[model samples]
Target: MNQLSTNWVLGHKVTPYQTTGNYNLVKGESPAGAQGPPPHIHKKYEEVFFILQGQMEFVLDGRQSTVTAGELVNIPSGCLHTFSNTSDESCLWLNIHSPKGFQSFFDAFGVPESEKDAMQQSLAAERITDVLKRAREFDMEIKIP
Candidate 1:
C-alpha cells in the first residue's frame, strides 16, 4: 500500500492520492469554523466534493447549501464555488478533480503537515502575489465577488 502524503493548506489537512487515475483524489479535513479557498473557478476541470463526516456549507454560484455526512456535491468546470466547515465539529471530505493535474496547485501552494507552523509564518510573511502567480499557472481564477 502506498502512504498518502498530507499537506496543510489554508487550514485544511489534505491528503492527495498518487494513482494514475482519470481524476485526482484529495481527502481533506477542515477544522470547525474554517473557511475554504475563496470562491474560485477552474477553467479546465470539474470538482466534486463528498462529505465523509460532519457538515459543510457550500456556496455554489451564489447559492448556499448545507451538506452533511454521506452527501455529495458537484461543481462543473467554470462554476464559481467555495465551501466551509460551519458546524461545531471538524469536517472530513473528499475532493475530486477530473482529468487529474489539479493536485499540482496544492503541491505548489500547500505546506506539508509536518511544517505547518513554518507554513503559517511563511503565509503571513508573504503577500498574495505569489499565490495569484501560482494560481494562474494552474488555470484557476480567484473571483473577488
Candidate 2:
C-alpha cells in the first residue's frame, strides 16, 4: 500500500507521491469545475493519467478530449497539456511522470489540508504569481492561451 499525504494542491488532494529515477506517481482527486495548471509542456517528462472516478476534460496540444473513469490519457514529452474536472462531481485519478522531478513544483505550492484557511492560502494571488514565475524552473513551460 502507498502512503497518502494530507496536502492539497490547487484544491486537489494528491498523494501516494514519490520521486524516482524511472518515474513518479501521485494519486489525486479533483473537485467539480476545478482545473489543473496552465497549459504547459514538459521538456523531457512523459506523463499518463488514469481516471478512476467521474471525468476530466483535457486539452492536449490544441485539441480537447473528455476522459472518463477507466480511461487513460497519454502525454508525450513536449506536449502542451492541461485538464479540468468538468463533470458535476469530483474526479479521482492517478498520474505518473517519467524521469521524475515535477513533484517539487507541487511541494512548493501544496498546503496541508488540515491547516486553517488552507484553500485561501493555496490560491492567494502572490502564490499563483510565484507559481507562474517559477514554473519554468521545474521544466514546465507555460503556454498562455
| Model 1 stretches with alpha carbons more than 4 Å out | 116-129
Model 2 lDDT at residue 8? 79
Model 1 lDDT per residue over 10-96, tens place:
768888977677888999898888777778899999989999999999999999999999999999998999898988899999999
RMSD per prediction, one decimal?
1.9, 1.6
Model 2 stretches astray by more than 4 angstroms: 19-21
Clashes of each: 0, 0
TM-score of each: 0.90, 0.92
Whole-model lDDT per candidate: 0.83, 0.85
The numbered model that scores best in lDDT is 2
Question: How does candidate 2 score on lDDT?
Answer: 0.85
Residues 57-103 of candidate 2 have per-residue lDDT tens digits of 99999999999999999999989999999888999999988887777
Structural RMSD, model 2: 1.6
